[model samples]
Target: MTAERPAVDPRWWGPPIGGVAFALAYPPVDLLPLALVGLWPFLWFLDKELENAPSGSWRGAFAGGYLFGLAQYGALLYWIAGLTGFSVMAVPAYVASVMVMAFNGALTAGGCALGRRFGIPVAVSFPLAWTGVEWLRSFGDLGFTWAVAGDVLANYPLLIQPAELGGVYLLSLWVVALSTAAWRLVRPRSDTPRTATAAMVVVVAAAVPAYGALRLDRLERQLEGWPTLRAAAIQPNVPQDMKWEEAFETEIHRRLSVLTLRVAPREPELVVWPESAVPSWLRYDPRTRALVPALAAQIEAPIFTGTNDADTLTGRSGREAGDYRVYNAAYLVRPDSIVSNRYAKQRLVPVAERVPFVPGMATGFFERLSAWTGQFSRGEEWTTWTVEGFEFGALICYESVFPSVSRALVLEGADFLLNITNDAWFGRTAAPYQHASHLSLRAVEHRVPFLRSANTGISGWVDPLGRWRERTPLYEPATVVADLPIPGGGTPYTRWGDWLPFACVLAWGGLALVGAARARTAPRGRGSVVASSTGR
Candidate 1:
């Protein structure tokens, strides 16, 4: 009974290795080309383990993929721990999110194995499976669009300008396709010519940037005469620990007032502050509410700053409303000493603001755990503000990461996008830069000038062509004043949102169905048919 134990599969290490490579492909390391080979180890492991094994070996594919995902997402998102550091539950909550994201990775691997076992080409199958899973990952309350493979290309704007056509997943598809093609060319196979596979990879790599270059040229020239708005985006460098302290409210206001005066010589038409720049709720506090208008009049420029606002809900009867809601709101103060527009944030951060569809989250243990953070009500409208003849959409923190929010604003006549965030919560970490990178794609996708004002740093502006300017350093208290261009017309992406990814999804599903149908029609013990003209 103490006989030899079963031997461990050598391929068990493949996923973790692949995860390391994948993590290296994102920020803090950001080896962009490494993404092309990041999945090679995992894919190679799948091919060797499942190619000739009994049909039941597909289970191993899921296990291996989960391991890879755990390593990949775990390493990629480790910075979340720093952002959630104050809570004792931070580590466990971060670990739980990593575990949930790993399931998507496992699903991708399993689908790839099943497709290949049914005789589909590995090059086609890998991208199809990956893109499908990634598209699904972007949905629902748990959806997190951070650190997708495509985000690696955010630094190379010309290469990713085509996000205007297909959104982020489209770029993910292109990256996975390139990786799969490279894997096919490098590995020995009974199917497909290596030369043909290499040629296809080269074509894809060359064609994407070529298309991007042409598009950038056209858009830049078209935007040459567009109206420009001079803005002073302020970074107060407030510490997260002291941000909401009652003792710091007056001091914080004085700090911002001084910074606004520092940028006064630039004579900006609009002065902007980061999210929740003031500690107190502006609408509820008469002094703070009056402060904005007075400051606007003193500067002789319209000002935009974040605050909390509360509105009482009255029933159909003219009686006092029993219900009240508080919003994470943005206010526009006119130079004429008037508060002109107020826009509430629509997409609040889950659990941090209001839990998703879980009423118990309101008064249960979760509420007690997050009591330090306010439970904010969601805004119902997609609102845009106007200042200095430019119409702009004000996206609160975390909202810029969602493509649909910015797109809807542009479609509704927003000429530019202003993102206000208090990234002090992330502290002196890669989280600020990582968060800023997501906004670049939004700028490209909507063909608008995107301006960002962060509480600490990485504040900047990106033009319609994906060309960026006025970036501030991390943890620095600085005001970036820039003349940002306003978009004159909508891009194709604004006209037809996410249609390209939807089409890719349809094609991928069809191929999977075809492969499944073919597998069922063939003999049970015949095994997978090797197609010589295609790589497995």
Candidate 2:
């Protein structure tokens, strides 16, 4: 007699719960082996749950996927509440932001369900679908690409070098693949499963050390030609509530000027100020133009500061007037010439800066909410401005989270990554540290050095191998001046991005098709048979 199929216990929730718990303990203070093994439970859960399930169990798959996503995002971004003042008045805004994040969870669910139809293993399908969904979500009005899965691997520098070939998506693929393979080996099965699991192990074992060795070799080469330039970053600690107040505008400018001049003796080749360093609109103020140019002359190097601009045009009412538009722009100023290069922030913080819409919500409410002056236009493209012999791209505040935005700039011939942010709004929470972690991934992905200047903390530099060269203290007024060596050669990820994830998805789809065909032709009454053709 054939062995009876084992019953799925009510306790099956354990694996998913374990997975969720593991994801919560990230941005680790100390490296632990347990954290590396944390994702295995989730993969195991997916494998076991789907192993004998019906072919069209998309709903179950989607529900499971969504639950996992919700847990992951909710845990990681709980610090977002730190943005709200914790007053009774700020409760609505805090709750609203959490709800918006939950909505992004649905995308993860949808991707999983769609991939399941092809009979692909959750290990292969989950990462691919997740990567694809993230790529799609990053575009248009509803984009929020901050909490990507690969970000969990940011603390491990040695494991992240592969990003140069496939970007963060490739890292996500590797993570998922390994977790799934581990799950398969834990619950040994057929020869195909064993072979697949063994193959995955071989690939990872080979890849990890090869990447570590390559990074070590590259580090030696980079150090041999370290470029030293005196650079200064200005931090003007302005209170968030008083930032827009006319009374505090002068104080803001004075503080920035004082900071700039203090560092001028260092004779920096480039001096960078945080976003909106000058509180007043630059185009409207002649004094700003005159004074800034004079300061640039004193510094004897280009000074880049953030300010607003106004564009004059005829209104819809047929009256010619100047429309005041606020831009988070950067200006390159020198004594003889002021070269203005502006990159209006592409990604605005939701609710704090802009509001996202709910499907079927009233358009009138959205319109009314959007009538406020907080809205800013996104720049059409990225441009690299030259300073000395270097061409660096600028990412203002929230723009640093989106890799494609930075990648597009790199593709446009940017040599290094420069980010100017005001993390003062988030105060002394984990938000700034988390934000800094994301920047590290971008450096590894493009094989470029990243420099950041922030208002009230966490200003630093990241090397090509994703190492943090230097950083300022959190929630403090400080300047980080580093001699960063620019990397000329790009990695495989920069040359061919996201292809690895796409290939994994395609492979999963093909396997699912073959499994479906096999199941349809199999003899009946095999106890509702469901078998995965290949394993990890």
Candidate 3:
């Protein structure tokens, strides 16, 4: 009898196209539904691959996964071009950044492929593998947790309360699980598939109502009445190119002073400026220091602004070394004595602020990329500054995305969170909106009010329930003044960080291993049969 030809495979096109579609769905735009459809092909591919392969082929999986990642990241982060002055320069950097992000995609694909080879169902393995990969991607040298799957629902606060339980990772897991489960049931092979899919649907459906009930209950509970304080977020609208120039320093100060005086009638208890509002070192500028105390006294509150600081000392080599530490630092200037609360930004943007691992062989490339560098020293500890009984944690620019960084501040006794950012680098792109959305999640996570003051607009206060009290227009010169209620108690997320996601990853890993072992010892004939039937 003639050997039967292997069944025609249909999964090869799914992942890459799905990844690309998902990328297109990301904000400051929304095409997520289409992206979901795109992902079906990739999911189908993995299902087929797993059924056919007795021993997982790492090489095939890696190649496919990497391509998918490349497409996904490339599409999503293409907006990074908004940061650079010229499109020529921006395009290359954008490409590089996307390439960096693709690393996560490759890992996710490979992990899923391996899991499937062990007979784990697509509904279980895809979500688990995705969760593990996302968690891993949040750390490491090129770590950037932006554009997370959970962030897709950022525009809708009501659906995002699950973040309080397992943080953003939980939401991501749910999205993946629901999508995969739906796919599995759409073309069911087993009699019980309907029941399994229905269960998944119920779980996902229940989360929405559960979250709504929790929000209603929380809102009904009376918040501890704190003194209503007015705050001014100064927007100087300094151009990115001129922001660092010596001539623009005086103009920036003038503009800020003008805006500060305009809001003085409202009598804001605190007047805040964006990160590095002052281009020069405060200590070196006697004129500026003379002006700060007067400004603080005039406002009858405190003036918190960003400035650079420097220190000089002799090194072990005996030659006097000038330690010019460029800080995305904040200063709290009071009338009596300037209680300087400086928070040097810990998480610097990779190439723009500080290059990672520059001490070794990468120094040459680092030096070349150091054209627009800010060699700022990272802060070692979280510090909460108190002004008139109100304690606030300060995050400068890019530090807002780091959940641990903000959570640490809350743990250290902060009543509210303050973020100072100069988003002129991103021009009029989705970066500012995307950056602003992170504050809402952080507020929900910590059950604390978040006050953001950005240079080029989108400055706002997010309440404990992820509600925006006030926000300014993007790329506009404006001020957002609002009264934000501070939550008295911390949420479960603030108390315990990443525990749920970590548990999920560990459980998935265990399952993957068990499946792998079973596949390893299966009869050769059975393995061949599975391989032939499932061949893609």
For this target, which candidate reaches the highest lDDT against the unseen true structure?
Answer: 1
How do all models score by TM-score?
0.92, 0.85, 0.89
Candidate 2 to truth, TM:
0.85
lDDT of candidate 2 over 161-242, digit per residue (tens): 7777788777766665565556656654533457777887778757855886787686767665766455677766677777
**Which residue pairs collide, candidate 2?**
118-512, 164-493, 165-492, 165-493, 166-493
Which candidate, 1 or 2, would have the higher TM-score against the true structure? Answer: 1
On lDDT, the stronger of 1 and 2 is 1
Give the worst 10-residue stretch by lDDT in candidate 2: 527-536
Global CA lDDT of candidate 2, please? 0.67
Ranked candidates, highest lDDT first:
1, 3, 2
Stretches of candidate 3 exceeding 4 Å from the true structure = 1-12, 31-38, 86-89, 187-192, 220-228, 316-320, 337-339, 359-365, 372-374, 517-524, 527-536
The lDDT per prediction is: 0.79, 0.67, 0.71
lDDT of 3 by residue, 391-458 (tens): 88888887787777788888898888888998887777677888888887777778777778888877
Report how far residue 481 has shifted in candidate 3, in Å: 1.2
User: Which residue pairs show backbone clashes in model 3?
Assistant: 14-41, 14-42, 15-42, 18-38
Candidate 1 Cα outliers beyond 4 Å, as residue runs: 1-7, 54-56, 313-323, 359-361, 364-366, 369-374, 523-535
Candidate 2 to native Cα RMSD, angstroms = 4.7
lDDT of 3: 0.71
> By TM-score, highest first, what's the ranking?
1, 3, 2
